[model samples]
Target: MSAAARAHNPMPVLAGAVLVVMAAQQAIVPVLAPLARDLELPEWSLGLLMTSAAVMFTLTSSPWGRAVDRVGHRTVLLSGLSLGLVGMTGFAIVCQLAVSGVISGELGMALMIGTRSLLFGVAMGAVPTAAMAWVAANTSTTQERVKGLAQIGAVQGLAQALGPASGFVLAFAGFLGPVWAAPAVIAFALVAVAVLLPKGPSRRARAAAAAEAEQAEAAAPSKPLRPWDPRLWPVMLGGFGSFLTLGLVVVCVGFVVQDRLGYEGADAVRMTGLVSTVVGLVMVTMQAFVVPRLGWPPWRMLRSGIPLVALGAAGLMVADTLVLVTACMAVLAVGMGTVGPGYVSAPTLLVGPAEQGRVAGLVQTVTGSTFMIGPLGGSALYGINDWLPFAVGTGICVAGAIFVWTRKGPGETATAPAPQPELAPDPS
Candidate 1:
């Protein structure tokens, strides 16, 4: 196919890839408790495993993204898939050996923790950076790219719903449940990459193509300048706050749901799925219809989302009734759904094509760090009072919103021209 044709198709593939990876990653979170018990590790230590992965993910994102920019998405994505496979295999082996009446106590726990962390790091760090860059490069219009991004989140929600639900079943089946399942997901992803992701054009080749396109478009008038950039600090800060809240909630949602709402173990798990599914659906609805028609400014989304998330914290604090808490969860979902697309789209809109991978990695790393902090912070506060952490979490979200409102940044308004759409067609 021609260069133009290649660019036209890559965006959809990018979105699909992201969804698949997210689904696989989230599938594990719900089952962590069981996995811990089965592996004979303490529940607290299992929590640490989750935190360790986030730290690695945050720290590595920028560097991996930069490398993607230098090399290509194909290389970076494949490397991530490989890491996932290794991690999953490690997990399976550890579980199998442990269940077979081998590797008792701390030794078994250590093995599970270490391998799981490594897998989490690779999965979290690589997927977002590569996928974001891939979409940015392939899509020709900002709206289309945003649509693609929204789809990724939607898929992530779907995955979140499925991962734990399915994982619960798999865990009981045996130690190899998540482990064997992980490889299957990775294999499927590999196929998607092969069929969907276009080979990116190299720098030397792209320069030649741009010169030709410039000559062709010279007679056409320039497009209007987009005012606010999406990459501004406010958007990133807002996203960090949002994810931080999510990480914390994901960690403690079971306890909160059970104690506050009169839910038992399995019931709490189901509720978690319901909340995630609801959020996913809401996000799909908003990004698909509302964002386009209402066309509220990105800042408005940020402002609104923060307060809604705060409401979730409040819901946790009071916990008077199941209905009340459920409403709060929905409110939080709306807030995140409102603001998330803007944040996801910001850096791509701001940076040049060459920097997409690096910037994406950096952003993921930053976001991942929030994931680490949220759980740790929540845990520390949870010790004081069950409600304390949720209360404090709400306060943090409110503060983040305030910062967004007062701050001047990209996505605040449509002042400057938004960055141009980047196009690269592979010769191969």
Candidate 2:
């Protein structure tokens, strides 16, 4: 179907589905300790669970993009939910039944990692890519697309807030019980998608849109998009750096609070949880209220966000008390909140509509890559000094800002990016 003739679609259903995927994924963080105990594995070995899932998420996103392009978005999304259900069920069963006497610790860890990865590969498949693509496809104008992207960002932030908080709250009720919450959530999400989703651009709609486009052939057409447009790299680099910093922070924060500050395990977890709560709330407010009021280009937000992240990380280097750490985290959250909305919108605006899935996937892949590397790097650096990871992570953010600043085009802050010409609708 042609892009111009396409009508704006209500995509709240798809956003809700993506939120389910994220919730399932994020729930594991708070439950990991109980999982390790149930499986009778060492902390180091259990770490493989995340490593495996991240590896899968990073490797599979592109193929998932291709699959969505080939299959319908709804089909692929259902497939992902099914995979998540199976993976979570497997985790539940394995934890309930696996005999440490027979399975051996290393082997058990390996099994958990494999199952976790399989689950992640499926649930995460089309979510990030398809959800955004659906938005870009259905939305009729650049302004609407920004609104769509902002909502997406807000939903993701809400997920970050609720997912772990819910898990932890359930954990507070009792150990191991919270871990069971994921399956139920996934199941409910599947049902919601089934009921709420529109049958996705109908065949008749596609054909009619296509016919109208041919009739308007004499009209002046928009310029073809340059996928490798020079402005793209700075934006992309900033995104990569931001995720890298985030990745490192997630993995290292607990260790810093415990080892460096001489806190107990519970204290460390609470501190991290508090930081997450603040970050999530701030993110929601920024996207919902602040971004709209300014009407500023995304690049401007990115510029402000990157340096704030640096300041937050730098503050972490000196923070010795919970209050100090919390304030620093708040600073970091503000920086991240500023940059995040813009980063989410960057590839969508840059690549045009036709390639939204592939390009958005590529952009999300940076996030996946950060997940793959950040934990490992942070853990190793934490061994050297608990403060070193945040310090170095801050430096990386600074470098990314410098790179973005040096680039051309009035700070490269695009107000309204061009949209792609629509492609022939897939029959699959």
Candidate 3:
């Protein structure tokens, strides 16, 4: 079907799915320490749950994207949802079993790593890969691509905000209530997607996309852009530094509240929730309402966002009070809100449309690698000293800022940014 004939923008549906998936994933942040204690496992081991997922995503995302390019988004996305449902449900069951002493702590942790982390990780990777590839394939200009990718960033912030709120509310039922609810919500989304989502990219749309790529590549034929391509490296480093810095702070935020602020268990969770909500709200507002209006180029956005991120990191190092921490997190959120669209969409601008799937996978792979290193690394750093993680993070952000400002990545700076369009396209 033509873009004009289409009844809905599938992007919004896809974004909604991401929002749910992320909300479920992030809900565990508030409960990680408590759950670890309850299960008689070392608290640091739980970070493995996240690290495992990141490892799987880093390994599998490229294959997943290639599948989307070969077949279509519907299959890959549905499969992701199905895998996530099964995996997350199994995860909740194991958590319940361990809580009841039906399984040993070691055994429970192992099973959860399998069901929740490893399996779920692979599932999570598929969502953004397909969604971004779909977005990159459809949009013809950099601004359009950034606007589309910013939707992904906005939902992630919304999820970050929502995750802890869900945890706080669900804690009334039981500690496990939020965990159990994740699959149910995911299942509902899966069915909605299976029915409402279009079958795949249509042949006509594909041809139009290819024709567009040809026009864009008239000076030189498009080749599959590799991660190591010199043209892509500056973009990669900027993305890597931003996420790595983020990882250093994110995995430690809850613990900081618990230890430094002398809040225990639910209080710590609530405090952490407040911080996450503040940051999430900031990110959501900035990406959704502000970024599009400004319509800055990807390079410019990256350049502008980095110093703010560094300052946020520096602020986090000194933030002892709950108010101070929340302010620092909001600062970080604003910087990331600026950085994410540029980081995510810049690669699409560097290559022709034919390589959108590959480039999208590469983009996610870089981010996923940070997820692997960030959680475990942050946890370990927090174990040593509360401020060390943020200090390190501050350094990385500064370095990223330096690189982004000094380096000239080809294609991104060469073309003037296209004029901003409507907030979003009306696919209806």
All candidates: CA RMSD (Å): 5.9, 4.8, 4.5
lDDT by residue (tens digit), candidate 3, 61-141: 878866775566778889999999998999999989988999999999999999988888888888877777667656655
lDDT of 3: 0.77
Give the poorly placed runs of model 2, Cα more than 4 Å off.
1-10, 33-48, 95-104, 196-229, 260-271, 346-358, 405-415, 419-428
In angstroms, what RMSD does candidate 1 have relative to the true structure?
5.9
Steric clashes per prediction: 18, 0, 0
Query: Where's the lowest-lDDT run of ten residues in candidate 3?
Result: 419-428
Error of 3 at 207 (Å): 14
lDDT of 2: 0.66
Q: Give the TM-score of candidate 1.
A: 0.77
The best candidate in terms of lDDT? 3
Which prediction has the highest TM-score against the true structure?
3
Estimated TM-score for each candidate: 0.77, 0.81, 0.84
Ranking by lDDT: 3, 2, 1
Model 1: ten consecutive residues of lowest lDDT: 221-230
